[model samples]
Target: MAEAMPQTLLHEALQKHRAGDLVGAAPLYQQVLKLSPRHPDALHLLGFLLHQAGQSAEGLKLVNAAVATAPLHTDFRGNQARILLHLGREAEADKAFRAALIATPANPDALRDLAITRRDSGQVVAAAKLHARLLCLTPADPATLLAHSGNLIDLGRHDAASALLRKCLLLAPALIEAANSFAFLQITIRDLDLARDWFRRTLAAQPLYAAPHSGLAEVCFFENDLEACLRHSERALELTPDDPQIHVRHGFRLLAAGHVREGWQEFEWRLKRADRIRREGLPPRWQGEPLAGKRILVCAEEGVGDELLYASMIPDLIAAGASVVIECAPRLLSVFRRSFPGCAVHAYKREGDRFRPVHRYDWLPKDPPVDYAIDAGSLPSILRPDVASYAHQRPYLTADAERVAQMRDRLAALPPGPKLGFCWRSKEVAPFRNLYYTGLSDWRSLLTDPAIQVVSMQYGRGWREEIAAAQKAFGARLHVLEGVDMTDDFEDILALGVAVDAIVCPSTTLVWVGAGLGRPVMEFGVEPHFELMGTGKHPGFPTVRVFTRSLAQSWEAVTGAITDAVRTL
Candidate 1:
């Protein structure tokens, strides 16, 4: 009867706890604990109630004591791990969860806790394995399926992740998270129509959900609907004011739409992204203030193409009485050094040991005290804030005269015809980016012109076969300069730009390089970049003309137009 009394009290406490009456449950649990001091159930239950009531310190002690009393008890250990995780004691929680798993290897609660803890601790592989184990235990759990799919995405197994998401949606069609994940994957793959459909479906499932609206905004931005992009982005911000990514996206949209001031303000959110480089021991960022004698470091932020594009503003910076230092990609060091003789040029040291270089500003000189540092991309916002400000448009980059003469001589030696440079592809192969390129076959119409001697300015490996195949297929002469390596030598490329009568290509770095060197370039693409936002004409280079493919038109039509233009040239 003595033990029976404690058991009866414990049963009542559990009933109240399950019924969401923590106030009624706590005292009954205390009564049971007083009768049976070392009872794990009573101790764990009371601790959980205390923790839920915002008394985590005392509750953690109680739960630890419960685990100590019943060391091998799976429930006790699992509860301890959960409480530890809740209190942000990740290391302790990880240990406790491992212990619980040792006690019962297939304990679902223990497995889930451990999996989440592993993922949070950056043990993604282990977390994914744990999640897989848990899914095997409960195959139809939508939450676990979603979590596993997220791990798959982190592992770059997107197709597998996509399959899992589809399965999750099938199991629970109303699952908004599954729908959102699927839609986001679609966006990553540049399946804009499918992405739009799924994002709308997610919105229908949960009207107030902010993420789908943000997704729609990105879709609209890529589709060249600036007003719609802004509308969706604003709505998303209204729904969730604190999302930094959405703010960054909104900034790009605004900048692309020619709302420079507002866009620049929003673009500041790029600093908040995890991938943004944080200069540990540098002075604060520059805020477009007058610098009479201050030394400013213009740090390169994004791609090599962006660095070259933004380098146009350096002479203006030098003219403004600030001594400028350019931190740029290693490949651009020579080009920038020669172009901007007044400023110091340093190659940004690649960050990691990975094969593909990830460039960051780790080479800033310490002795020369920098008054301020600014992102290169941010210069447009400060220096050229409106369409009128872009009037200082002249060829800022000059090719090496010797390289120019060399390339010019080589081109002159070719069979008597117009020397035309062409690049059909870009290095970036993301699904959305693929939309920017035309297949080599699509260039046949342009290549078939016997009056033109097509020079292969296409860079990267495996291009020789493409050029040969095109020549064979079209029965036309497309000449590739034998000695000049176009990929590594930016100076030679600039010289080639000078040598060629004109350049014909899709929007790529070659277009920027050609335009920067004052070569007449005809650029074709679907989306309008910020450089060509207000007018179809490039703001920085008058020699470059943009031809955008209409949404309804096929690549054939765009190429056909180019063919006509080439014939006229």
Candidate 2:
């Protein structure tokens, strides 16, 4: 065998490799490679064998060489991508997987791995496409079916998701993955009882699983079972203490259930989340520290709604004599600057999940400079710890005085009836969030009432056609103000919300703007958010109230009730 020809040695190596004799295979692999340098098969297999032997770095180097030599070989590229993932080079791994799929589009392993990668990274749209292709290739795999169902759920194709989930469970009744997906599917469809049942079923199979407990907590919260909500939340944290999302969610659960002290403490865990925007070069987090003269950077997170919600505390910061630097969304820069006259507001651009500071104020100076950066969401934990800590929401955010006057004149021109501005839908109508919103169609009867004048405050791109359809169907036109790009004009939202007689809406930027303007805000949702602090009403904003439909009640009934409430106003 030592003097055997390269083909014979390679054949022997392959045979031993297939027989699980890596020790026997390694020498043959070496002989083949020694006889024939740059042999792709020998290099690939030897590298994989070393990787199996816990020598990943050397294995990756050899595999990289193989991929470089034969870039079009799907097998080589496939394993090379796996090694890239092992080294935690996810972006490179994803690109390599795409190249492998391009080479062999029907490659089951490539499809499965890449689809799983995309699914885990929150790229549901791309993952769903890959999952479809993979299911075509390997239709019977329970895991693929389970994963694809989740993507379907995220994409808001719940009926398709339900069908896939049912098929996945039918094929593998005791599969925990299928059980979990099935539970989430039920929750997405607003079947809380069924979701709770499936979650319990999943827990029966795997008692130590934290996710089912968290899911149960979510169901209990939506069902208004506050005790069970916090209990399951605690159990979830007990099972998986290190999961930041569970901690943050438990904070919401606790806060909503009236546990203020522990809630703020737990809510602070959001900063530890992997998905939180990176404020790498910014100042250290100001954890209730003394900031008499220090310049603090209070950066906004997620959206302008969040900024407006939390900016209610900036006055307190200024009162503490801190020189404040606020970073907000581009749309909010003007309003935030005007609202917080003392603070310098800079508009920053978001690059994926990282912050890219556009221009810095003098406070961003390097020498002994801004060493305290805090997320706007984090301020409540430090500043407003209890109920009385609120600054009493009497229009903390200010609109342009002239714009407000103009909006008032515009409203007066509509008719001699009560003007009710409303946002009927959230821009994100995904499964998890759709529970918080009743669609525009659900509010048709309410919006069509001729007594009150309806103004379309719904933002994002498609609201005009939707409002027009409402007008065409009922002949009661919802006044959409011209020149107000509701999506981009944050200041106009401030103006319009302020000038309106009342605001009736689901959660949106308009909620904060209206509530901040001290207007009557009749917020409708499946349940009151944790901001209500379990008190049925927002503590600071006296004019704001949450109207909700119980699990036993329908959305249409809730909308009808909201209509009656608005008519009285």
Best by TM-score, which number? 2
TM-score attained by model 2: 0.90
lDDT of 1 by residue, 121-192 (tens): 667788999999999999999999999998887776788899999999999999998899899888666678
Query: Against the true structure, what is each candidate's TM-score?
Result: 0.77, 0.90
Clashes of each: 0, 0
Q: How many residue-pair clashes does candidate 2 contain? A: 0
Query: Residues 261-345, candidate 2, lDDT per residue (tens digit)?
Result: 7798898898777556656567677988888988888887777788888988888888888988888889999998888888878
